[model samples]
Target: MKTCNNCGAQVEDVAKFCPECGFKFGSIAEPRAVVTDMYDHTSEFSPEDIANNKLYAILMYCVSLMGIIIGLLAAGDSPYVRFHIKQSLKLFICEVILGLITGALFWTVIVGIVGGIAIVVLAVVDIICLVNACKGLAKEPPIVCKIGFLK
Candidate 1:
């Protein structure tokens, strides 16, 4: 087992994310600064370009599929918009699957309530994603980002 840097949680050696805190495991133990550096070092895109698309990016978080459609149709040309839309789409799908599983488990009162709370917490994370987008981070939400693809 490996210890997660962010939360100090023990994870399976092959785990891609920290189950406790959702810290993404990169080749190096701590890659937060490295990733930011990589993005900052890029010369191709201007930060202002990302800042300009903040509205659509926030919409992507709040509107789910509708946000994705708008982002794809109107802001596809912008990488920042596309990135947030993809993350939003991922969250929407995750929510549906989670809802189905939780709904079935509702016979257990505690499980139902906990699952419902989890769903609401997940939704709240999207709000953080929205704020990040407005701030021009455009990074993935902690849990959704670590999940890696719709699977």
Candidate 2:
């Protein structure tokens, strides 16, 4: 039996979720490649750096512009925080550009549809970056990783 991390419910080892709280335990067969990609940067930084600057790194995504400023001011020397700040800054710039393009083309209904979809994509990328920061990993976020900004 395995204990559910979400609600402390006991479940069978083969179970994919917590029956009591609906928390996803995930499948044991999930691909290792996906997991590895997300945490591939774990060995790049010292645990001390990740532990000490995690909050500032998370802040970089939580508040965008202000978070960048705060992260730089409070944890300027932390490579982990710096990595996240650069990633978050790229996301911020992408959002700004998307918003401007959408606003300028709002008169066309097509722009609304395309903009809405783009916004969702950007949100997902932002979540990925935020999660990586919270996990103290410097994994570059998908899509955002290709953007050439804040380098």
- Which prediction has the highest lDDT against the true structure? 2
* Collision pairs in model 2: none
lDDT of 1 by residue, 58-118 (tens): 8888788888898888879987776777778888988898899898999999879988988
List ranges where model 2 is wrong by over 4 Å.
1-40, 148-151
The 10-residue segment with the lowest total lDDT in model 2: 27-36
21-53 per-residue lDDT for model 2 (tens digits): 988876433456544565257678899999999
- Which parts of model 1 have CA positions greater than 4 angstroms off? 1-45
Local distance difference test scores for all models: 0.77, 0.82
lDDT of residue 43 for candidate 1 = 34
